[model samples]
Target: MRDGLSQEPSIEPQIELTRENLIREQDGDSKSIIVETNNSKTTKNSNLHNVIIHPRLKPAPFKIRDAYPTDLPKPTEICTVNDLKFYQNEELPVNRRGFKYKLCKPNPIFTSNYYSTTDIEPYEVSLSWFDRSTGSYLSQDCKALTSNQGWRSVRSNVGIREGIYYFEFKILKSDDYSHVRIGLGRREASIEAPVGFDGYGYGIRDVGGELVFISRRKNVLIEEGFKTGDVIGFEVHLPSLSQQKKEIEEFVNLKKSEIPDHHTTKKRKTNTKNKKFNNIEDNEKFNEFNNILRDQIPTKSKGVLYYDQFEYTKTKMMDHLLNPITVFGEKAIIEMDDKTKNIPIISNSKIVLYKNGVKQNETIENLYSFLPTNLEEIEEINLEPNLKQQSNPNYKNNDDNTLGYYPMLSTFQNGAVSLNAGPEFEYPPENTQIKPLSDRYNEHVIEEWYWDIIDEVEAQYLDSFD
Candidate 1:
């Protein structure tokens, strides 16, 4: 009586549940189920089943695979290539850091001063002059050097870490406004600045014959300043290699500990968002990632793979002045042994100047104090210790082998000077202890022979790796 025609008795709908039905339901391909009642027909979708919730797991942390092989025992004998390979490997017990060690080939013909010698030529020592490739403001023959603008300096082709040697400089041309500074500088000394402008050099200025070191004038060496056509001689004395062997060994050990193995590759996740980097930390991270990528990429020049060569005797300018000379002096004195003291009491090195053939009264003593004894001391002056350790990877400090002096000459404002690295000098000093610089040839020959052996050994060792 309430509705039109549904007054008849209503019955409950019957429903069937099956395993295949549940499987079809989960697959989202189940057909709709129809339930027919006495009063009305009803349709229900199979997807409306009880929902089950499950916990999600975070992705495994990003991992980096180890690039090197298993550790190898330190080689006791380096006679074969395999033994040399083991000796150079980072996994060995003895510490070593470098991409690869290769021997530099020796030149067949070597020329110095006005003399030339070949591998077949008899062994005869000679003096060294200004290296033509090392100076752009020098004469075509490299005998005379002139500078018309700012201060420009050039060093001789050869240098010595030990022994007493003498060289002469003649002021060929100089005006009232022209100036010159003659001295000794290490390889890191800047060629664009005065010789004594930095700690790596010690010079005597022509202005007042003033002794200059670390950019400061210490004292007057000559009462009468040198003029045009004046001859100045320099005498250098350094401790023997045996005397510094202990210190050099300690330095090498320390450097081996500090240097990291550069053979491994580093991976980093880079940001993909296109936004400006306002945070310094983010910028630094980004730069570090880029540098790692750059190092991994191979660089080819003239069809040759350009691996960074080991810089044994050269370093960056900023690295040359890291610590003060006083630090090195303290270490040198404290590390001296009885054997080192048994020799002559000339433990302290010096640089003595001579006007014409006459020796000057003032002497620059404690030359070893100025030389960098360790890699830590090869940083810029006034630079914090932490900052020195953070120097650019490509600008590392030179090895202790490079801790020596080369004949240095500087000129300014059209000043011209000629080198007399001689077997015969216009005015040779009367000092019998000091030998002419030409005698460096004997040392050079011995050094070359030593390096030739090293090169052959390195070649054999590298071949084993391939």
Candidate 2:
């Protein structure tokens, strides 16, 4: 016998049997046999008990219990405490490659390195500059300062030049919609104005939950600003060597632009006029006019000429440069002295702000270019004025390249804030994928994804069963 399709010999054996043989075969209980015959034949007995058949079965879907992850941390618990909680399990399950844990806990190594007590040292506020007599020193470390007057601020004793730093400010007391600022700044930042009121410093302030940049010349509104009880973290990254050089060059160029050349030209005109006039009376009149001009023009001290008359004295000019007028909008214009106007110096580096554990969005990133509602009105006010010119040597003494930034705090009347930088930091940052003050030029970090094959397998199995 042969198969009809393949035309090949059939594997089943030819059974030559009669009724007795059939009965014996059934009694023997052969499992599976294909009966074939070279000649025509028929079974003599019918026995169903001896025969068996097996069918293919599909596998059941994998069923995992809900209690698999018994140790996932709660977000509320993480928020209540000051210290950080870290988890070690970030990889996928060993048995199931398709499944993965999100590892929501903060990175332990990063958190430790960031809030390490070994790196940062303790510093106190300068009593000579801030209103120490009125506001109480809230912290035993002497880092925190507060005042109820319209505005009060203090500079940190330690200054930072290059390196990533993390610090925080906690609002202890303030009225509704109170102004709060946190940022890095130089000594030039006026003690009277908030931290970012001057171009030398950068700060983020709260105005109706909106973060605004407070600079000497401009007040730019950004995203949501922090309020009372909010722990605001600041990450200050100083400029690189190349960036510092570029900024220094820009400063030099600004210096050249600020000093006017008209004084020399006007003096030459007077000299030529005097040469033409031989009359004694005319000479006396010219001398009188020259004296008046000399008093009106700014005096040259060293090589730099002072332009802003309100900042006429050498000390006042230094104050104007260091302590900027902090008022925003048209108020700044109204407060400007009638005599002299000054422009702000924009820096190359920047800092980032964080609330709780999450990073602030990039929309409000740079505090240097922030502006309030009335931007155009603020820019029109001039900072330079014609004033009595005198020679002064202190104008050229500022060292642009070597200048470092110190942390500053300002308190409006009835507002108070506290500071923390390592050692005694009450609240450590929650998310620590990157170091503080590192990577200021990039966007926020995104989480990675793992394969989800379990869902597909379950769906396919259900469809087949149905």
Candidate 3:
């Protein structure tokens, strides 16, 4: 009785339990004892409002060519931070060592190479051609993979169609060939892509309007029939318009078939004896060795290499186009299909050095002065598209011919990604105009890596925190 009376409930600590009575309850029998002391310091109680930004997640602000170190991200505003400084001990948990950011540099880098990225590659090639036949889809034979064709490398690199590549193409031409168009193998154009991304990729067009050639640098030009032999190069753009339609029909107003790029060498009539000097070697090997030393004479002597003919058609264009050639350097000359004296543009499109921006009525040879002085600046230079403006002024779906631009569009609504259209490559000069991407229109919404090369000082600060 005395023990019960002496047990004062006020003095006897009545341990309280949380909602989880059993979980938080202290195991003590009316005895006060310490279990856990709040001695271990952690980030849980950190002053998030005043905490420094994490260096890992910090973003570097934008700047011009010459910027100061202090011009970097600085915590000026209460919310401003160079990086969101996350503590090592986080309750929710994140792998500290697993922290990663992507480092990518868009190809054909330009001044405004804007683009978006998916965790994975864009599955289907997507393109909305400027062609009039929108609803009706068509499939034509195309070799997007041949070396001479502009698309050879891109096809293999991008992983199109599973054997079939499950690719979609939109011809810029309104008409479909009675026969199938053949082969759009691989050709990639990551021209003027935004920094830190791969923006310039090729996608087939859907319209059959006259081809509009644009330099990688944004200079627009028109092409005519081959005068002198030139190396012509073009990109194969296989765009997946929509899975709903399988067949895409394209009719060529130009009446040229979509085939292989024609590579023909001029045939030279060999006098059994040189009409100029009759000691021409009888044996082929002797003539070959003689020709090797032909250049030994000051003026010049030449030889010929014979090859078969390959055909090509601009299904995407109302007129047939001679794609620009990849200048492997030096001179490249080819003859016409008929083996006539007509000069070919197929082999010599890239032959003349692109020295200057497109000039008014300037011959291709005169443009050689425009070669980039700085090789390092080559990556930033945009190549000129060897396409001429449509001959027909009343071209279909014609916009302002003087100020018109066609940017890459998406396939599905809120799905397809836009091509890189940025200004990282060349700085647009005054009086020049910029064609907005929105003018062309995009059906899908856009969503958006690169590594930070922290300086030694920055590295030390980051390591010190670690």
Candidate 4:
């Protein structure tokens, strides 16, 4: 300090260091030590010691284990049954919509006022008349026969031939002005062939209840009854009234081989163009006037399933219409007299079959070919018809005089709403029996993905090191 400048006593006190940190730069000074951190606070105990073990380890056994992994494949098959054990967490499908004729407000309220059981009493009645042609019941003048009760029972002849006449009974209040509950009426028509000519014809409600039209001729015999009409009838038939609803979830497979594609050629004057818009071309101009729209249904390749002939049957009591009934009373019982007679056959047929289109032999032959080669063993027997038709009439109808009144044949209303019919009932049962794996829609690829994911997840494990 004296050589650089002038020597001087600074007004500052010098303090000596008592503690110092010596950081070694050489690697040889480094060493591992135990430190306490929040994460590794267990080492704070002085008793802590390092553990050394071999590389290999033995797995500890567990008393129980889970068989399935988190990566288990989802079930692709649908849950059809409500209580399916495989899918406890899922809900089964159901239809909540009820029948159209179900008791709903306003409709029922309206219907109940008309047939108020609490207020009105129902009645039962039958009608008969004399016929100059048949000599049975005298054919009464229909209008004259209908007691003035706001309705007519007039017997008037209609159709090309004259003999077809209807002795109609309609819904009407009694002349006594007594209101009645009109449910349904039964028809028991028993006609006898005249001595010389024939007596056979058909009847129906051409436009429903408005008019009960009979095809009075030698060739066509139609008979019809009604469950609903405006004029209250002379009487009504009452049976046990009940209602039931059924949910039909069915599977119907269409086989291409059975019902082959067919086409019929005929003359038609209808416009045969697609109406993409209202605009008409010269050829389609014919549609603008008469507006007759004609089109050919485009043919499509046959598929595995087809929607055909769908019918719904309900046993529910309809408020407006009465359930149909077949006669078992004396009105239908008949005894024919022995006399010379010329009979007439009545029909409403457009197509006639010599024999039914039953391939009975073909079905039998196919079943035989499917037998086992060695065939000493027996298989369970299945004796059921494979194909079906509407009604299978077992006998023919005869109108000859030799046929005295035939035991009252079964009678029916042409417009009676029937409960569902045909093979639709069997559909649900068939859909249930099919296995998922056997179906083409459920392919093998789905199963392959399931096992692959399951195995891969099961292969993963927790760290073996402790």
Candidate 5:
């Protein structure tokens, strides 16, 4: 009021109240208000949207500082740092306390794809019929009686329901029966009968090379049967088709009931002709010298189905295959069954047989009952329909719940034979041509042992510090 000539009318105090002013008035005069304005706007046109725009700024470049000792104080005799003093003793260098590092040689590796060390014991049993020696580490060899019709056999250490397996029988000696059969058989088969004598077992027989017999009742004259020092080879191939068929049918074709025994047929004939079978009625004992000649015919039918000669033309060629045995480790490769998870060939599982290095002309099929699944895995898979349907009484399925196959062999009395598995053999069979029984087809599927070994190694490593 003094500087102004009575300052014409203080216009600053005469301002009009706005909505913002009313809000501020209600909030109280203690709160502050800020006003911002773009004073440097450059626009030729009076359009608010035509203002120049600036791009968004990026984040500032960040850097970690280099931490280094610098400008340190000079060392002083009266330092604040507490010195760590270590006392020296007059002990010898050898006895001095230090890291006692000693490298140890690694232990030899023992691997088994099928049975572990403990589970493989059952395969080395000596049954009543077959007398296995003390050296029967893997049940690879056995001694048989020399009596005619006197038979002794044993189930193999490894049973294979599916795959191709080649086993050899070395003729250590021969008796009057002069019969030594080689091939695959079931545990339920009669131990007192040679292989192929019953339906449960299938094999080829060599009688002093005078005659060769295959199947149950088929006999063919040959130059000679296997003699001492002769290496007779038997091959087994479990095709995939057999397993697939088993999945569909409750019973596979091969497991069908065998033909009627001689006594049963003779009784039927007697009823028709008013005559009687006066001989000892033994259903297990079939007449080996029957008039009906056996052929190398593979049949998918299980029961006693009658087929006339006219049906031969319509028979599938694949069903009538007759696999031949070889000698002297000949090279004979024959394709077995269709490959599957357990079989070889990777794409389609089929077992092949080889003598020496040559492949054979024939192949064996229809052997799903002889193969085995992992015992540790059997309990978990017991409820599976496929395994339950394709079950065997000889092996555990329902009660025991174990399913596995071992190598099996049978010999008549007066016939002595030696089996060559991998462990006990003068000339071990080459594993090159065949997939190992201990080999798993798939690697991704881990087992309990895999985790067990891992946990064991970890524990051992941790214990090293103690």
Candidate 6:
């Protein structure tokens, strides 16, 4: 029935399916046999049998392209564990917690045998002058401070939590509208405001010699006012360690209870596609990789030759006024629990004022009651925690040091004052028990020695882990 085939075989008819024959067969012959081949020309004919080809059915060979930038600069070399030894031998700049660096200064007092080998001159622990970095409108030497427009306050470099210490201040100049307020303030006290504008500070104004706390003034403390030439003295006495242990424990417990449970907090929903990569194992691996990468990347700031990371001065919790006092009895007290019996009390701490070496009759007492009682109160007030405290969980627990009070000075328009943290005072306190502010140098040396030992131990512990 086919034209290509013959019944008789007198001579075998030879035929080849060439391009022309295939084309001719395809044009008219529906019953033509189709052949599939690897050849490029046959590919088109391979689908001639009403067959459909989808683009997604067969994937094409892929060639990956470079996605990263080629012209990126190489990263600077980072410090490693092995490189720490080299840094120890060299004098490095002191780096504070908030990425701040203190400018270089000579320390004559720090001539200890421990630091004799290195050129690293440690900073003096004693309060020599007002801190220039922390205070505005301060002189270059930090001894004199002035305010032009509004109230500007400055705290001493060092502060004390316990012991009876005395310091003197002399008003250099004060205009007709200008005034000065001298007091002690915690780190949380605002420099932009007067010393006693907030709860964290307790001050006395020169205008009326009135006692000030939480912006409220009480004229009963000092009857006579001081002038520009008068030398004002402050005597601070804090409770000893034995008296504060129980109270500190109770306060710590209250703070612990106030901290909300992390599990109870609402969590953000993760992407469905990325759920597989969000597991703990993956996170651990990522952290490990990140740490390695960080070690290879430099963290040094510009112009810094060499430096060491140090914890910045931590800020304490803000205090609240227990009860508004109009007048004082035999003793001014702030009770922790008014209803509870024998509850730990924050009393006996006193602040004595002196005008021109003459001791004032009135003494401000019971200071601890004004300090922060619990951590919840701190959060409710929206107080910001320090960098170290925010990052380290155990920081609060380990730092049991009581809220320290620093000599704070505030001035009004065109007001100026000079500090006298001295070995020699123009008007020294009559009390022999109360030490001069210069005696803090001994305490500083002792504290430094203790810290040095701790640092050595920490380094050894880290080396063991490595």
In order, the Cα lDDT scores of the candidates are: 0.46, 0.36, 0.18, 0.17, 0.31, 0.47
In model 1, residue pairs whose N, Cα or C atoms come closer than 3 Å (at least 3 residues apart or on different chains), thus clashing, are 127-438, 319-378, 321-379, 321-380, 322-379, 322-380
What is candidate 4's CA lDDT for residue 28?
Answer: 26
lDDT of 5 by residue, 376-395 (tens): 12111111112211211111
Per-residue CA lDDT of candidate 3, range 64-108, in tens?
A: 210111111111211111121201111111111211111111111
For each candidate in turn, the TM-score is 0.51, 0.40, 0.17, 0.13, 0.35, 0.54
- lDDT, residue 41, candidate 2: 18
Ranking by TM-score: 6, 1, 2, 5, 3, 4
Candidate 6 wrongly placed segments (more than 4 Å): 1-135, 250-345, 369-395, 400-403
How far out, in Å, is residue 454 in model 6?
Answer: 0.3
Off by over 4 Å in 1: 1-135, 247-347, 368-402
TM-score: which is higher, 1 or 3? Answer: 1
Model 4 misplaced stretches (Cα beyond 4 Å):
1-144, 147-154, 157-159, 162-170, 173-466
| Candidate 5, position 292, lDDT | 18
**What residue pairs clash in candidate 6, if any at all?**
none
How accurate locally is residue 335 in candidate 6, as Cα lDDT from 0 to 100?
Answer: 35
lDDT of 1 by residue, 90-199 (tens): 22111012221111111211111100111211123211221222222544344556655678777765577788888898886666888888888765555557888765
Measured by lDDT, the strongest candidate is 6
lDDT of 5 at 52: 41
For candidate 4, write residues 1-466 as lDDT tens digits: 3232212221111122111211112222111111212222333322244432212111111111110011211223322111221111012111112100100000011111110001000000111121111111111111111111221111111111111111122322122232111111111111221110111111222122121112222221111223332321111011111100000001011211222245222222223233222111322333222221111011111111110111111111110012122247645533232111111111221111010111111100000000001001111111111111112111111110111111111111111111111122212122333221112112222332343233223222111112
Location of the lowest summed lDDT over 10 successive residues in candidate 6: 59-68
Question: lDDT score, residue 127, model 4?
Answer: 19
